[model samples]
Target: MKQFCQTCLAGLMSVFVMFGFSISEEVQAEETGQTAYVDVSVATLWSEPNETRPVDAPSIGNPVDMWEWTTGMSYEQKLWLVGNLQTQALYGQEVTILEEQGDWVKVAVHGQPTPKNDLGYPAWMPKSQLANDASFSTLKDIKEFAQVTDPTAWLFEDKHRSDKFKEISFNTRLPVVAETKDAILVATPSDGKKWMSPDAVSIYSSQEDIEKPDGQNLVDTGLKFLGLPYLWAGTSGFGFDCSGFTHTIFKAHGITIPRDSSVQATHGTPVERDDLQKGDLLFFAYNEGEGRVHHVGMYMGNGKMIHSPNTASTVEIIDVFESDYYSSEYAGARRYID
Candidate 1:
């Protein structure tokens, strides 16, 4: 009886090994709650796991080739991304893994708000772009963080800036490990640690420590991207869509807003057209302001607004009433900031 029991135990252990399951691994997964961080400079979230096309290969590469990804797409291909490409998450952003299928994972991005999920905006992204390091979960406890203030910044492997680690987009926040007079040591999602120049970032003790900027500050930040080519569903300095441009501009100032234009039109304080302030969000609809909300722009005061209009346009300032299309479809405005 003893010999038979030993054999059975050995067989069970083999089965566990074959299935790649262990007590420690199970405990680690439970502790982490399947949390992962974006490992790439920008991880594009898709409406579905299989929504990517052949031309999207460059966008998914390890060091995402944003330039090739944008310049390579044809006009039609760019328009196709309007609905199929959901949104994007910057490097080091935390996401709660909801589901996994093959090489893709459905995650709720922490900062982006949406009605699709109470946790955050829901979207599917390639699994390879995420880092599942258990150590990264501890970042939530770190009070001090370094936020990228510039349009773009490079992460260095050393303080001397000898080796380039990665080029991160604006608004990317990472837990600060240490700081020097000219550089900051930050904890990365995949890479162990990297250094950033103080000139490109601002240190905040906590999210509450960030001082809120007024409406004009928002416009000043938006103005930096003038002439940047528009990209559908883009949320990085490399490119931006209509709502993405507004969302990123607000996010850089420590404000969290909805990820979609239609959803964004619902929240925030409603402002009358005559009372519109600089940085107020102006929305547009399908049927002369009566139909579904489809587009959004930041009010630039004096009858102008800044927006990434469409795939064919760049980040430009335009007279809101200059174009008949926008004037006829103007849907009211909303104020996210007081």
Candidate 2:
């Protein structure tokens, strides 16, 4: 009987190994280190634990045609063009530390997942980027939080329009102290309570705001980012990717959309290309009418669309049907608002 039982146990262990279910709760706990929140308003998530290579450095998988584009650009322009593939973690963003070495830490960032990492959008951020503040872990302690609606906002020293200090990017969350007629009082990322123009902010007192997605207001708010640089995976006016641009714009209006173009394509009711209206999201893929969406933009009426295009470009208005690239690649559209 003992010999028979030992053989059965070995068979069961083999089954477990074959299916790849070896990690137990204790093992998982041992692998996962500390949980931390992003300490600053924004932190860059790098592809590797090391510092990002200089913008002018040759990219590993870059297309052969891009060599000309890279050489024609100046060093400063190349620097601006770089870092589009990296994503950003916002203030109070939660992440789990997986491994640490020296000053860099590998973390699984929480939010709309990206295709970059199977382990919940894994990336490397500097150790100084994380915070263990009790405030982040306990949201009930916060009375209210101000959501930045503008592409970029400034906290003025006073409401009288003199002496401005800190500048915050879009989609940043800050705790609100008071609400006045013209301004909302909130703690600046670097300073104490300060007044910011009410027009540039949306105050959320309750969690029901998600039920009300203001598409018109979202489109109007997105217009403020015109002429801003295009940063890959950016969700702020400091820079923005196509989906990040749309996501932050809708977030300002209390509608939370996914963080990538492919996922955003699956959201909302599908709209016919001819029926495209302001605030409608347009998607594009390389295969003309079929295939995975790789880009997104907001329709601006009269055959025009607003988007961040790609690297070496800024947020700009384009004739959607007039541009061969967009016209040929146009996949479809969707309406998320009433």
Candidate 3:
């Protein structure tokens, strides 16, 4: 009887192994929920299942309290990237849980895009970074809110950065409950009422602002972050990835585009390199004739293009044909705003 029982147990374990099921996996499956927000200062997105890399970390200027550290981020533009990776989602960016693979969770980020037949802005992030406290919703909700339009806008307890309360990224939309002449009162989920400069935000009255497809002032809006540092996978002015620079630039002008360079390459009408105009998106690859579209830039006429090149770089205008590296890898151009 004992020998028969041992054989049955062995068969059960083999069955479970063949089907790729484990006791711990079942526990994680039950604990994982739908949507989650980045609770930390910043959450970095990963390309593969196990990948998270930090970029150019800023020198921690004279140590100060939380308020000073948060406040100085605006004028000094320092101390924010201490231990963060380049491809990051700011504090409030929402992500939806798709599936759980051990300690990693495959998620689809809001406002980001993936290929047609694939999941939405699909990426794998550590399950620990996912939080359950905050609720995630679409950007079109019928609330009178102020959309952040600067590289990093500080929400002050009073009016200016001197009385800084908190800091938020460029694309983060905050609910506006009241307004003063110089500042707008915004309601945040984690923090209560906070005041921000009126000029730093664009107030939306109706859904027209969200649905508008015209790239009215994209290039001009993009030029605002000329001196900002480049972070990997960053989608806001606080720090911008190459594609993130294009994504947020278009968002400010009221157009929704894909998030990644490769996916964005498949968007918009194709244009010839010789016919490139202002506001047209230019992409690059590895080889001379062919490679995966890995980088993107916005043409600013005069043979110049604006891009957040890499982790050690900042948003800047560069000659498309000036450097042999960029000129050689030039893939093609696409016009999103016609």
Best by lDDT: 1
Tens digit of per-residue lDDT, candidate 2, span 92-208: 566788877556777877654656554455767777767676654555245677777666677778865477755666777767777879787776433345778888877776545
Q: Each candidate: what lDDT?
A: 0.87, 0.69, 0.67
> What does candidate 3's lDDT look like per residue over 108-131, in tens digits?
777666663143566666776655
Q: Over the full model, what C-alpha lDDT does candidate 1 score relative to the true structure?
A: 0.87
RMSD of candidate 1 to the truth, in angstroms, is 9.3
TM-scores of the models, in the given order?
0.88, 0.73, 0.74
- Model 2 clash count equals 1
**Candidate 3, position 218, lDDT:** 69
lDDT by residue for model 1 (1-338), tens: 65466567658766877899684432221212477889999999997775688999988767787878889999999988877888899998989898766677889998899889887888888889998777666874654889888888999999998899888888888889989997899998877989999999998987778889899899999998999999888899989999999999998888888988998999999999999999999999998899999999999999999999998999999999888999999999989998
Error in Å for residue 289 of model 3: 3.4
Query: By descending TM-score, how would the candidates be arranged?
Result: 1, 3, 2
Rank order (by lDDT, best first): 1, 2, 3
Q: What is the lDDT of residue 178 in candidate 2?
A: 76
RMSD to the true structure for each prediction, in A, is 9.3, 9.8, 8.3
Steric clash pairs (candidate 3): 86-232, 87-232, 87-233
Candidate 3 versus the native: TM-score?
0.74
